[model samples]
Target chain A: MKSNSSTVKTRPTPWDALVFAAVAALAVLTALVFYGPKARTNAPLTCVVSVGGEVMDHVPLASFAGEHTYSHNGYTLTVRVSGGQVEVLHSDCPGQDCVHSGPISRAGQSLVCLPAQVVIHLESGTDGPDVIVG
Target chain B: MKFSVKKLALCAVLAALALGLSTLENLFPVSLIVPLPGVKLGLANIVTVFALYELGAPEALAILVTRCLLGGLFSGTATALLFSLLGGLCAMGVMILLKRSRRLSVYGVSVGGAAAHNAGQILAAMITLGNTMVVGYLPFLLAVALITGTLTGFVVSLLLRATAHLHLTNQSDYR
Candidate 1:
């Protein structure tokens, strides 16, 4: 056995560097375009109802701010409405994408972390979409 | 010709280790130098990388799946699970594909798998949101994938080296 520390050199290949650069560029570009000021005011603010998975057509989109638990099939969705934002505070699915999506309030504003098959969307009406969470 | 207790024990230990790594990584989120959304080191994948080389794909899948499921219970929001599952499946598929192709080294396989995982997760996000706008964030995810994948691969290599003598007698060792 020898201490192979005398002549050691580690260098990243050109292709590796290129891949890193490309990926970095893409991440920066995505943040710029999606979070840009222009996307902020695309539509007048409105309420949205996004339901999918198990719960049938019963969730009232108008009274979205209180703590409510909606269960359908095997999935569970707990919504917490604060101020104007409505968000999934808890769910029983395998992926926790929904909880990490933060809060969504503005009309046309939506956030979904899909591993749980949960969907969050803004509906225009103060009443109903007759939505089914299949 | 029979499965040995030693083999079962090794698998059990590896599975536990993998789960532990997943939990540990989830403790703190690493914000990268680049301000890209959903980019991180994925330190738990280090165990997955090691499992791929040492225990093979099926074992790795078991460990990864157990970690993903139980992990979701701890801190992950629902959306996280969807993203992780999509990413893990894509990564596993890519690993299998590369495994079939004799040209790729373990490191290469790891990188490919990591990249696939990120791509898959991002694609899932895009589909769920019904917006293609998320695609723009891909480059950042890729960057995270490449760097973390390479590091994880390197760690796996070191682990393999340290455990070189623990060779079990099996026809399908694949090494």
Candidate 2:
């Protein structure tokens, strides 16, 4: 009730308390809308790790351009990048969210296809998130 | 209740503008591959946010419903309509909540709405496909959501600022 009063004063009356309750309820409901059946179980997620001596400076289309692969959940993605442009050449995942992403060229540009558990991001600048060892 | 031709006309005009902006955002052929399903800039949500704060829930919903239904009909493929409905409803609900909390200005509402829209769409896709692999893309989608959401939020905030004085009177009954 106190929160309601404070909210009312801070906000407007035309949009009232019941509206607030309903919205909160909706937020919870939406968050709980999980997909996939628990019965079948999910495939183990496996991702390839490439450790570099130095941080990536730019889009490495030349070095990793031929083909790149990533596996997660139940999907696998194979991508091709040429001359600083990238596209999903093949994917085992259905719905083709990866194939639909087309390509990425800019330094800050990124393409993520959820169905295939693949992400292609162009690393910017010389410095990036630091890796720590215990 | 007397009919206000002027009010209806204004809503219709805003709805049209929203629809037009939505179509324009798709013209850019640039696509980035992120590990996410159906990621988008959500430029159209700016208009929905504007309609909500400048008008009210019902009017904003009217704009949102019309835009989602018609926009889908015009540019969307099969199953896109379903995704659009889920996205639009999620966006609207977020906007209304943020507006009530006073934590969201028009711009904030726009950002929240856009983020929610993407989340809703991804959820729909996952359900249809019966896959949890899609969930791995959630983080990447959130990243795009942040960028586009902020942009749309800033745009709608500007719109609300220009029309702050205009409010729906008792006779108009935006409720």
Candidate 3:
């Protein structure tokens, strides 16, 4: 408390650097643990749409073979749940991050619209990325 | 509850500023820049940090809660409200603790808040989505938080220095 807290001293101290490094390490470790290599399977993929943990839609990935639209909280989203992939094609949500997530073909992948409380995830038995290095 | 007129007016203005910033941040073309899901600059955090340092903890908390509620109404989503409230509270709690500790600078406090906000959002998602798979993305989100938090801390530092003369909060009042 020698000086004031409103000064121009913004240089991150060594401790600050250590905190950043710790976060980075934690990130890497979590990635490795969560996305580690899993046994891939050729089983069929099922697309599930859940809102507030309630299943709104569940269909075989290729059964739809068309654009399916879902709306919540005054926002609309168009998703492609066919052609061997599940992806959000368009959304009126402000962030549009879900739309930008591209398509998820393998199991354990998800497209989440936080604003709408919607989660569209691909599920399969014993199916995940065979290789997820780094 | 019983406050000076100046405090009341300042809280209203700060809350409004935070709300406006939240709306503007949502409009940011973050997809083009980060191409990551559920990530953004969190521009509203700037106002929260400013208020924490200049106005005091209660004022900052009030402004944050007000902003979240108003932002939820503006977005017309209850789910978003939950996430905002959770994330805002988590970030605020961490920043307040760090600020009180006086062990780290604004950079550390801001960075810690950003990371906490993201983690809180992910936790909210897990509860709403009823699955833990979303945790896989936590690493990526935290990585981005570091950079965004650094930028926010830089801006807060600048604002603190530039406006130090005003002395909105007496030195002994908050410190």
Candidate 4:
């Protein structure tokens, strides 16, 4: 084989360095956005459940103490609301991505089931912002 | 265009290698390490980078599409197939552009491809979930893509060097 000397020179060129630096900058900005401070609220938690873009049910976290199941078109989603938190306890979706998403407790947080077209968003009050302009 | 027997054989071998690497990667239980759904090491990209450099753009695309289809059939669901198709196509497009530009090395081309793959996957997720919030995962995915893409690119560089003497037919046609 030809001497592997050519491969040794495959060091990062100026262009490579520029690209890496740009990506690093993006990473830092994204990290800031991802780990940035959030608006905190002390009001009672309300979980809004929607299916097919229509509001299906609304439950106060403090009042809900047990598991609630919602079914649509043979697909089932079990939601648990307890201790001021909401989560998808179980789902019959093929990937179970919803169930694995853990829980949502803070306002503006949401749990979505794509297969079932279900979305559950946590809010502090019923009259709060429809969309959190961040 | 007519492919010579040698070129055809090489393409088949590269496609098989890409498929094998993809399959082997799926068996590793990577979720334990990454803890994020749909994150992958993208090992098959090694072969892709090799094919891009050695066999040219069109052949590399052929290898990529064939491997994705077969890999999807073997060990993935329909959703997985969709994600792979989108991701692979995006990656291939970026790699071809970078390679043709000749402004960056193979490593840069691979990194570009990997990042594009992640972007494509995020786009797929956003559309599938009907939620724009899915884009929140972009930074983490891009970071992972940088690491994995660089590693795969480095390996391809090594492979190209080691087999530099192999004079396959029509190798010079594209260059």
Candidate achieving higher DockQ, 3 or 4: 3
Top candidate when judged by lDDT against the true structure: 3
Which prediction has more favorable lDDT, 1 or 4? 4
Best by DockQ: 3
The clash numbers for all candidates, in the given order, read 26, 12, 0, 0
After aligning candidate 3 to the native by TM-score, how far in Å is the CA of B173 from where it should be?
5.8
Q: What are the TM values for chain B, all candidates?
A: 0.85, 0.84, 0.94, 0.94
**How high is the CA lDDT of each candidate model?**
0.63, 0.60, 0.80, 0.78
Q: Which parts of model 4 are misplaced by more than 4 Å?
A: A1-9, A31-134, B172-175
**Model 1 ranges off by over 4 Å:** A1-134, B1-4, B32-34, B168-175
In candidate 1, what are the lDDT values of residues A47-129, reduced to their tens digit? Answer: 44345654333333445458866565478878787776788888887777778778875444566646545556664443332
- What is the full ranking by lDDT, best candidate first? 3, 4, 1, 2
**DockQ values per model:** 0.12, 0.05, 0.28, 0.24
TM-score of candidate 3's A chain against the true A chain: 0.62
TM-score of chain A of each: 0.48, 0.46, 0.62, 0.63
The regions of model 2 sitting more than 4 angstroms off are A1-134, B1-3, B29-37, B165-175
For candidate 1, lDDT tens digit of each residue in B1-175?
2435765676677767866776666565566445565776777777777666666677778777877776776665877777877888888888777655544455666677788889888888977887554565566677678778888777776766666566632424332
Candidate with the larger lDDT of 3 and 4: 3
TM-score of chain A of 1: 0.48
